[model samples]
Target: MSNNAIIFISVALILSALSFAMDRQKTIAGFKRGWQMFSRMLLPFLNILIIVSVVLYLISPDDIQHYLGAGSGLLGFAIAAVVGSITLIPAFISYPIAAGLLQQGASYAVVGTFMTTLMMVGVVTLPLEIKYLGRQAAVIRNVLNFFAAIAIGLLIGVIL
Candidate 1:
């Protein structure tokens, strides 16, 4: 395993031990709650992994490069922005997918835009946002985020 992973695990173990020492019952309860949450998320996480793996396999590398590579330019950014805005996928799943896209020859700019929009712009959740935040705030937030994501993607493409 990587050194970072090892260090993280070791630190977690140390902290967990410390917690157990300080409050045994509370530590045990926290562990139980964490395990329950992990178990609940495991199935859906696996399902998403399977679906993403299959999709990645089906799409050709050349196609990815053509659509999302450096040469793709404005069209690529548009595609990435639109799709990213529309998808309601969780960030945890989206990160792996973004890595997969990069591995498949997508441009840094495209991936950056896609990731930014996925996290920032929320077309799918707009109605809910509107309900909670009001129509003006929700719409403005989404619009500003959409533009910011595109600009960031372009900047990443230029810098990288």
Candidate 2:
């Protein structure tokens, strides 16, 4: 594991030990609840992994480079923004996929745009957002976020 992973694991273990020391019953209850949540999520997590794996397998690295690499320019940014806005993968899951895209020759800008929009814009969840925030607010938020994501991507390209 990487140093960061090791550090996080160590910290978590230390915190858990401290919590258990302070309240054994609570710690046990917490563990049980955590395990239950994990079990509930496992199947869907695996399903998403399988689907993403198949999609990645079908799309060649050359195609990824052609569409999202440095030379793809504004077109790549638009594509990433649109797709990211429309898709609804959880943030934690999206990171590994982003790394895979980087490995496959996608530019930092494209990946950055994609990640930003994936998290901030909610085209796929628009109806739900509208229900919660009202149509005008939801639409405005998505529109602003789309532009912000593109700007962030451009900055990432320049900085990285």
Q: Which has the greatest TM-score?
A: 1
lDDT of each: 0.96, 0.94
Cα TM-score of candidate 2: 0.95
Q: Please state the error at residue 8 of candidate 2 in Å.
A: 1.7
Supply candidate 1's per-residue lDDT for 78: 98
* Model 1 residue pairs with clashes: none
Give me the overall lDDT of model 1. 0.96
* lDDT per residue (tens digit) for residues 69-151 in model 2: 99999999999999999999988778888988898889999999999999999998999999999999999999999999999
Instruction: Please estimate how well model 2 matches the true structure, expressed as its whole-model Cα lDDT.
Output: 0.94
Tens digit of per-residue lDDT, candidate 1, span 25-74: 99999999999999998898889889989988999999999999989989
How far residue 71's Cα lies from its native spot in candidate 2, in Å, is 0.5
| Candidate 1 residue-pair clash tally | 0
